[model samples]
Target: MDDSEADDPNRTSPRPAASGGWSRLSASRGFLLLWGAQSVSTLGASSASFVLTLEVFRDTGSAVALAVLTVMSSAGNIYLAPLAGAFADRIGHRRAAILANVVLATASAVMATVSLIGPGRLLGLVYPLVLVSAIAASMLTLTLTASIRRMRQDADLTRINGVTTLLQRAPVIVAPVVGAALYATVAPAYVYVVDGLTSLGCVAALLVVRWDAPPLAGPRRANPFPGARDGLAWILRHRGIREMQIGFAGLNLFNGLGVTATTAYVILLADRRWGSASGLAAYNVSAAVGLVAGAALAG
Candidate 1:
């Protein structure tokens, strides 16, 4: 998920019932199921993402197109996040999460079909499908994250948060290796099918989780813009957070460029390294090392 979700006001949802401490949460079927499902989905999505990037670069050989894809995703997320979050709040997180997974699974299946038959390029289907998939993913992330807070009580908040943080970041280490191997061994369309299956697995996990997930209280607003405005207003009133947001904005301005450049660089390095897929795996490991280190330090 993007860091932007953290700052976005519309991502907010109703808090889960205080279920006790970390020990209690550990024993809670709902928390365990959600955590497990999220972990699997994250790893699968990460692998699928690398595969998609590899296919895009291999086909088009254009980092610019990949960059454009990122821009499209950003625009879609920013525009639809409020409505997505609101919809999640309306339906309850469990249902919303399940639906989001179903959406992703369906999208992956469609993309796979397109790739299977399309000539060279994707017959102009890649970007739109990718955009919708991203939007669903953002919604899923928001709801799942909010659900975590609700699942546990305040007593072990710090520890529970740290553990969840690790769970979220650990996939970076494993996914690249797995993705690279899959890319090297399987057809791209088959890899996409695998991605779709992972999402369906997540749906299964969510279904088995029995939780009394209540919808967001108060009258359902016809327009989410007002809530979004209120959220922004609240953030603006906080000097430190507002300043932090500004700093983050500056960082994000160049992040897309950096991501594109890095992806191209890695692919070029992969070509030079002979076994291109394996080389990509190595790069992913190095990058993951940095992420893990950062998470460790933050912890």
Candidate 2:
């Protein structure tokens, strides 16, 4: 192929010079770069979440801040998702994702540095920064997940998803002890710094990676939200989805002694022995490991 044709990514007859389109989705060098970067930073993010909450408690001795932080962050996530998802699709997914990563990294770095400078005096800043950083991280996650949905094939997509589940477990397997070591030997400032630097790893990956959405042949829809609504509406009426939802609800409803009882027992045990953070880490790690193993088995 000549240079001009090679440059034309939207060409349908002669697809872009990638492994067949399907393979392209699975093994794109750029995609892999983003994936690897996210995996590492995601590990850092997990640890940061744990340490940040602890840091907040240590600084203020107020569980109220922690509760407020969690609730407000969650509320913001559901409220802002439509906008975040729309914006990502409007821009290039990869680019928006990078922007979100930058937001996260910068927030983490600023908070870490400020915490070191002011110590307890900067107490109010901790939860605010954490909220902003968490929001950015959520936006990044949604953008990346949108891209993942456009994968090569159903099975290959599963494999790609598996990568994340595996990465999620890594922090569980290693980060708690690591966070403890940092808290014991260094300081919370250093723990935040670790997360902030890992965000840079994502930035580096974005630098090397590129993705373009399928070309629009005509004027793009004025707004994609209607189409999005149609999708949700369709799912609402779909028999398959209906059955799945019912099954899911049933499963949740049926979860009894094994679920709540075990969880309660574990929580009490964790509180008495390991402390909440370490105990939660152990559970998440085990869950992540199970998910990864399940994904591998599926593959």
Candidate 3:
């Protein structure tokens, strides 16, 4: 491609290149707004998830409850991935993203209400709400990524993805301890309230930010299922994505159980000796430190 075409902002799905770092991305105000919104949402969701874990373990003290909660949170996202992608493609990513935020905000409100009713009394409802929130969150992430791809070059996408991963992991470093402390000092409902309000902040940012939406090839058909099927077929034809998907499938299979089991194990350890919150927070922070180190190295 010539210089003009290479620099064209309207291009979609450009081939990957070695773009310059944060300087290029930061120059775009729209990207900054999206990044900032996502940062706030990530922090809120991270802290809320931590608090939920604490609440469930504190009440049931059963590994099974934690396992069930983790499964519900993940299963919905896995099941909805293709549908969410198709939905984003059908209605412009911005609209889909806004819709996802609305769902997340509403889910947070419902959870807050559930907390007020007491988690034990409303445990059944809580599981479904968590699943809903997870599904919305996955949709929001997919749409935001599609927005990024539409707005920036592939090289810029790489840097932005790195930075975004850092933003997402940054919360894991502190949210656990902060959430646990808040839960112990205040009430669990407050954590949910904070998360809900932060999500509103993200929605506000999304509303004001402006970007060019990529045009669809044609009008979406009445049924999205076929489009979703085509997308899956496309992925299957790509060796890299196919392999990556297989790897992720295996990773999730093991990682999911290990993660939930570790939480239960740590809580049990804390219960046997030290304070529960501190121990759980320490373990979380420690793991997050490794993640931060890895991110820094990758950057």
What lDDT does the true structure give each of the candidates?
0.76, 0.64, 0.77
Residue 236, model 1: Cα distance from true site in angstroms: 6.8
lDDT of each residue in 82-201, candidate 1, tens digit only: 788888889877788899999999988997887677413872688888788888988888887777666665775788778787777888688988888888888778877888898998
lDDT of 3 by residue, 1-299 (tens): 23543455533332233364443443466667777878878888888988888888877877888888888877767776767777777766767788888888898889888888777667899899988888888878887776666556665677877777777677768788788788779888888888988888878877665444543566677674776688899999999999999999999889888988898889888867777777888888998898778867997
Q: What's model 1's overall lDDT?
A: 0.76
Q: Would you estimate the TM-scores of all the predictions?
A: 0.81, 0.67, 0.78
2 against 3, candidate with superior TM-score: 3
Residue range 171-237, candidate 2, lDDT tens digits = 5567655665565567777777888888988988765554444333445556746577777788789
Residue 48: error of model 2 in Å?
1.3
Error of 2 at 97 (Å): 1.3
| Cα-lDDT of candidate 2 | 0.64
| C-alpha RMSD (angstroms) for model 2 | 6.4
What is the overall TM-score of model 2 with all chains considered together?
0.67
